[model samples]
Target: MADSLRESAVGQLLRLVNRQWLPYPDERPEFQLPDYDTPIDQEKPADHISSIGPDHQPKRRSEGEEQDVEAFQLAKTATAERTVSRTLTPIRTSDGIVLVDWYTLDDPENPHNWSSPKKLLVSFEICMYSFAVYFGSSVYTSSIDGIIERSGVGVVTASLGFALYVLAYGIGPMLWSPLSEIPSIGRNSIYIATFSIYVLLCIPEALVDNFAGLMVLRFLLGFFGSPCLATGAATFQDMYAMIKMPYLLAFWAGAVTLGPALAPVVAGFSVVAKSWHWFAWEMLWLSGPIWLLMLFLLPETSAPNILLRRARRLRYLTSKAQLKSQSEIDQAHMSAREVAFDALIKPWQINALDPAVLFSTVYTALVYGIFNSFFESFPLVYPIIYDFNLGESNSVFLSVIVALMIAMPTYCFYYYYWVEPKVAKHGFGPPEQRLIPALFACFLVPVGLFIFAWTTRSSVHWIVSIIGVLLDIPQFAASLFAANDFARSSVACGCILFAHPMFVSIGVPGGISLLGGLTILCAGGLYILYFFGANLRARSKFAAK
Candidate 1:
């Protein structure tokens, strides 16, 4: 009876809570005579309440009782488990900690409860938005040649425009993303700032006197467009339920990876056939309306931000009304300044301090490099090998996109129809299911490479070489899923860690910067994913690490 009671309490506290939730179990012991400046009396429900020991007798526990905790409060409390994801539960104590949740499955507030039409609407809009915003981030690279020709900059110096743009992505999100949680200013401000910055960066492309200025401006353009690129960064929280997010993230994962590959095609044409400045102006025009639409249509997805706004409204009306405080707001949240500072340092700190996290970051960074190589190798391949002009060579890169389009649906079908049920039944995450597609992809890589490398000749039909691109379609998508799934899994310890402001509580991963580099990186990363995934099913330590 005692064991069952304890189990019941634990199960309620842990499992019945939000899927995004988990508490960091504190390992430390509590101090004796714990300081308490104030105490409030509470009415205990006679039915649910019980006293430990015989006849409901109560006494102050002595030294020996400390270790075992004769009753509940007898043990020195190091930490109490609170729901991790920081969702706004309805119940609240004076200090604002929720003692128990009254809501869980199918809660209307949960993104999972959103209507299918709404979900699809948001997903489609976001996809287009991400496509346009990300295009600006990398398409600017296509104009590098025209800028170099016009400004007479050397080759190495000219490439900085491309390098700097990527660097902006690494830097800007760290600063601007936190403001996304501030009320009325949240994601709206982020979009405005990012676009404003991008517009400012465009000035150099329009009026620069030298290559250096053009390079600097291009980098800045990417820096500003960064927040825009990263805007969908939190969409997973808004569009899908906890369990549902893994499947959707696969497509999100693909879109982010595919963006860099596709950009060179657009930039290639604008630079080769027209002036360099056209690329900047056209991209800006294309994305301008989408950004404006986001201001009004982008709903508040961060639950804390929504709660902060709700609390303010409650205070406005009902002068005699009371609002409950949550435990997290009291303990984990900080002033605006501290949050900004912490957000800047958090990704790097988490990556460095956690070995598992560090491995995942490095692994994904390689994927980014591989994706970027399309820009590098496309120019090299068509012009050097096939004698195609700059514009013509750039179009060839589109072959990879054709492959991605075909493969994307295959992956979606596998996950929704075949894998989601298994993940639910086994407590396994999306990463474990990621292997089936990735194994197919890994085998395709060499075959594709052989075809692409050997068949681009007049003697061979052009279609023969194109088969390699076909193989890469699946390779790109599946490899992308492996890196993201593994990194996301590790970031939470092993499966899904508790959500804190500092970590992935919510976020996702990036793409190609080479063939050999990406291939080697993919091989190594996926190999790790395969081995760990296999062992994970049999071992509990690795399962919940």
Candidate 2:
């Protein structure tokens, strides 16, 4: 039965890939332009073929044999509207024909309407930005011992810096996400500005002489660097349709997961070869060019922002007072304080009150806290139990990356072939469908934790403990992805806030056992969501909006 299932899954995945590359044999032909070079009277209007009568005869043209210019223009406009109306918003032209809003259908400024290559390039850059910042967060873990030795702080105290940085980014997004969404400011501008400050803060973090200075700088670094984490997913909503979201988001989630997992490998080498401060230098060198690429190549993606620019240009040239984007018109009456409160404070209240958000927050928080605890526990378990060097100790994290590689494709296959087909058949089902991968993840989390907990004994092989760690990676990835997809951004902040205190109360081993138990409890919550999520969404005023 298992082998059969595996083969079926593989076949489904192949079909999915094939479909992406080549259309089905019976698919309708795409729209083609008419040969306008020939005089209007000499050529047949082939554009009207698709709109022919049921008898398979061409419809009579509104113009007689003289070839009416207005009739030809109307036919061309109608054809364009039919081709793009599903994806782009249509606005009536002065000639009584429709074109896409702000600009024509093929406008490069509209992120959603951009070419696939352009969208992929932007997604790649944003994922790189996310990877760089998250890498900085965990690279510090390998340097914890160096930090303790140099600053005369205990392991617990040094660990606080990591905890605080995580907490800061979680909270920082509440402030930054709102700012980034403003039509005048926009996604790319916030990315460039905050990221520049974030990189500059790293220098002081490396050079700081005291523990207090280190903590302060680390907190600021996370705070300034948070836009990538907070608003990165929102960029996808701007760029892709719902059907393509899962795959693109999986790529993004992979990059986010890889950053921390890959960090320790590099940091371990840096610590042994040079010093802990070298990790900081490494981050600086790596992140600088990413920032530059974003500044130069990443365009403004927010639709309101693009339209606002167009509105401004139209107002300048034509002096029309009524020409304004929906965002501008909506914000015209509200003060900045009102806008901020609605954007920032309202989301928090909704997240707090909503059952879906609360459950997702708890699950994501537990996963995040456990992942952080690994940094503290690994040194104790790997080096002391297995007698491995720093590099080998760090290489254990590669297992997490391997697990992620396996998990993402498997989830993609299941999602595309199984869940997506159901959704397509039924129309968008409950948000709980997003949690399907996460449900299995809940069981895996505990299974991995228990394995790690028992296998860390001196007699046990180190690979057993590594396997335990490996099991948690897919769960972590799945849970984070589900929560981000299903719950509000405020849930991310709540998870981070909750993670800091959890990590502080229990050291690594105790934390692992606690997380294992919590996973079982969270799994029950997932079951509730799976069964009742649609009903809850039905009752939610916020979900209605």
Candidate 3:
């Protein structure tokens, strides 16, 4: 009885682990589940010739009847096409190894063919994961003063906790994203593994006594939690067709933006109630549950990885040694230099040399930098000018969230009405067509800056300055043109480093005016790029077709 119970417990544990962490076939109910009692298999090829039902199956006709014969031929051709669609077309290598792929376009094993509700469940989980990870970056900032007092560190030294964390996460994707792409490694494994470490590290971070230990811990936390920021979009691409991806990605951007926006307020309140250590404790509390949720529910989303596992199963079942996944086959031929070029050099190559890419990268980096600059500038503006407490000052960051809420639906409507029709008809217009909305929105950044610069005072209502901050929140280009998220984050890190000093030296108004002036210059540059971008793309080798 004891031996039987042990075996059963082990079997259940294996099944649970396989279901949660491993790549497996999706078995979700179809959008329109078929009735099993229907005589689907008995239906003949020419039965579909009728518009109504198989009851209208062609009756026997005389041999001389040419019209009926022609209809039958068309029906046969249609049936052949349907048969081909369901068939498994195997890839054979030079050495005769069979490369496995989806059994059909509509294969349940393929992530793309999963039912809508299943895909949505996975998408929301990843977005929530992104929220928890990004929420860590600013949660520390809520208690920077507490850090300064407890650790005997200067404000500059304490600020390194935030700065280093941001910088490390930006650098992390170069390592993590590529690893996740490997068929054996896969996205789900990387997410749960690294995030578990990140969650555990929070405990040490909260207990650390010195500035150096805390900074290192924060950096580690950011580095491990970095995968969901960039790779989460890749997962969406795996499940969603191009037509639907833009809308889903818009939600993803909102999730990422919402995290940092809400974190400060929560952390600020916690810090006031408890101590700075509570910020890390709160991070642990937030992330630990998210990790548990992901471990149980986040199935592996990488198609290549799914196929690789399927290939392994096929090898076992069929007793064939030659079965391999496309990814494994490619990996066999791919050299170190090719991997390096793709992972490292290519993002920078296009980013630096292609005029369109450079313009997009710079624009995104600048906007992201400005966004990060807020964490620094808000401390200067709200607390000093408005004389608000910590929680109240951080509450103003909710304006960013408000701006995102306003911008998302408006962009969705524009994409549906304006962009989708063009794409559906012409199959994507000139790249310049994408810049149309940006051309109008670019001016708003500086407008918001100048408004905030001029209006942030004792005489003005705080809402007016927040409105200025709200105006500064126009950034569609960041998501559309971000070639490399880490590179952009690194640029934003530099901006974070620069912002506090600039705001301190120049005062809030002067510093903001300077930022506004710089954005105006960027707007002028964007105008030139919008009109002349094709000429620049014509000259470049690396521009996306």
Relative to the true structure, how large is the alpha-carbon lDDT of every model?
A: 0.50, 0.67, 0.73
For residues 82-162, what per-residue lDDT tens digits would candidate 2 score against the true structure? Answer: 133222222222222211133333444556555566778779988999999888877877888888898887766777666
Higher-scoring candidate on TM-score, 1 or 2: 2
* Highest-TM-score candidate: 3
The true-versus-predicted C-alpha distance at residue 156 of model 3, in Å, is 2.1
TM-score of each: 0.68, 0.77, 0.83
The segments of candidate 3 whose C-alpha lies over 4 angstroms from its true place after superposition are 1-85, 91-94, 476-481, 543-545
- Candidate 2 backbone overlaps, count: 0
TM-score of 2: 0.77
Of the two candidates 1 and 3, the one with more favorable lDDT, higher being better, is 3
Which of candidates 2 and 3 is the stronger one according to TM-score? 3
Residues 1-545 of candidate 1 have per-residue lDDT tens digits of 22121122233244347322321111113312111222322222111111122212222333443433222221111123212221212332345222221133233333434445555655655666666656665676567677667778655565566666666555556555656655445564466556655655565566666766666776677667656445464765654545466556666656765665577777776766767777777666666666555533444455444444444433443232344222224324466667665655555655555545555566655544444443344444456556777667666657766786777777778777887667656755545455666656676765575566556555766566567766765565433433232232132221111111112222111112124334755676767767674454444333354
Compose the digit string of candidate 3's lDDT tens values, residues 1-545. Answer: 22111112233246567633322332223332212122233233322211112222123423433454344334432342212233334544434465556665346556765556667878988888888888899888899999888878776677888878888888888888888888887887788778889999999988898878888898899899898875888989887767677798888888877787789989888799998898999888988888776766666778888788778766765567876676776777778889878877877787777878777777767767776875588988788888999999999878877889788898899999989877766876677887787788888888888999899889999999888878776463244226666767777778777888888898889988888887888788788888999898887777544
Worst 10 residues of 1 by lDDT: 494-503
